[model samples]
Target: MFSLFGLTVVPAAAAGGDFAPPGCFGERYGTLFGQGVSVNCFPGEGYGYRVIAHCANGNAFWFVVGEFVPYGFGPAVAECSGALLVPARVVAYEVDEI
Candidate 1:
């Protein structure tokens, strides 16, 4: 039923950490959840990891793994604006290490 709308949901624990953010895993992979993920601790700048969330509305989110239950991220959903159900503030995150 939901798959028909192009959604790629996954476990939350697969994309979070508290190690030095991996260089190979810089701010580029996108945002992810951390519920069933398997993270190996390594040396990072304080705490490090990446995420890549495949959302339900054909859009995904990208952010450093944060501390929370499931420790995950869903699509960047803006309020539905217009006279329909379209998102109002359609904001997107662009990963640029600088």
Candidate 2:
């Protein structure tokens, strides 16, 4: 379990395969508990990562992977200014360093 911005997150760990950095895994939880979307990135045994969450309300949220468990940004219910902000998809990029 992990916590970010006051919300507890349970990460479903997996391997990102060849396209992503070695041992990197990213997860997207959309419209969490009717609140908003969340994106999490884990380096696992590899390098860092980043996430960009696209929403139905035309808003986009970006989260850079930090050195922690809930290492991303999420539950952005307030950022959309009352719009649904339904998450369309999450794009993740692997950071070879940093």
Candidate 3:
């Protein structure tokens, strides 16, 4: 286990290699009764990263990954289509070489 961006990175065994997937950590605003969903992610160092907002009504919204910079991009928010829709989960993954 190692620390990355103030978070612990645990290496897991994969089919090809043992490594830790790059991810982000932060706070998510709003609840089941809120108007919109937003996430503030402190993404790990990489080419870039994006936030995915999964809604309760099976709708998924993705925030585009901006250009790579030293400080990175700003926070992003996705609006749920249904009324009083809530976000089931917000995921942030690194946009590494592919």
| Cα lDDT computed for each candidate against the true fold | 0.27, 0.36, 0.40
Candidate 3, TM-score vs. the true structure?
0.34
Task: Tell me, by lDDT, which candidate is best.
Answer: 3
How high is each candidate's TM-score? 0.19, 0.28, 0.34
Off by over 4 Å in 3: 1-23, 31-46, 57-71, 84-98
lDDT of 3 by residue, 5-73 (tens): 899988754431212133433344554543233333454554444334434444554443333333245
lDDT digits (tens) for residues 7-75 of candidate 1 = 866544533332223433222222222211223333334433333222223253333332221222222
State the RMSD for candidate 1: 13.1
Candidate 2 vs candidate 3: which has greater TM-score? Answer: 3
